[model samples]
Target: MIDTNQFLAQMQEVLEIEDRTLSPDEKFRELPEWSSLAYLSTIAMIDDEYNVIISAADFRELQTLGDIVRAISERQP
Candidate 1:
């Protein structure tokens, strides 16, 4: 199983967010990661890391990072 901590840390690194008001449980839209560029970065990260291809619109439907991870797993063959 992929480590959630490492995944979240990578997410933080990709988004350039910290643990302050930003959290894994928090909505991406609620944080500075809501930007279009951030979405592109996230899509790249997910695709490169998990072999999953999803769009920012797909991510908008999620509730949290947990949901995003689940989506990535679901797309796995």
Candidate 2:
């Protein structure tokens, strides 16, 4: 199972944020580091770290850090 800590670390790595807990209700739009480049980085990060290839549509649809965790957890190896 993909724990929340792992999710946070991955998010921090992709979004270039300090490692921290992102509450489920926290909107990603509040993060200035979030952008097209960050999303691309996130896609690569997830692929490299988890061997999960996330679609661009999926990436665009994600709203919060928890949304990403849920998406990644739903992916098959």
User: Which candidate gets the maximum TM-score versus the true structure?
Assistant: 2
Candidate 1's TM-score reads 0.79
What are the C-alpha RMSDs, in order, of all predicted structures? 2.3, 2.0
Instruction: Name the lDDT value of residue 29 in candidate 2.
Output: 65
In model 2, which regions exceed 4 Å deviation?
19-21
* Candidate 1 deviation (Cα RMSD): 2.3
lDDT of 1 at 49: 86
Clashing pairs in 1: none
Q: Give the C-alpha lDDT of model 1.
A: 0.76
Q: lDDT per prediction?
A: 0.76, 0.77
Worst 10 residues of 1 by lDDT: 17-26
**Number of the predicted model whose lDDT against the real structure is largest:** 2
C-alpha TM-score for every candidate: 0.79, 0.80
Model 1: per-residue Cα lDDT over 1-77, one tens digit each: 45667778778878887755345586777775577788788888888888888775776699888778778777876
RMSD of 2: 2.0
Task: At residue 38, give the lDDT of candidate 1.
Answer: 83
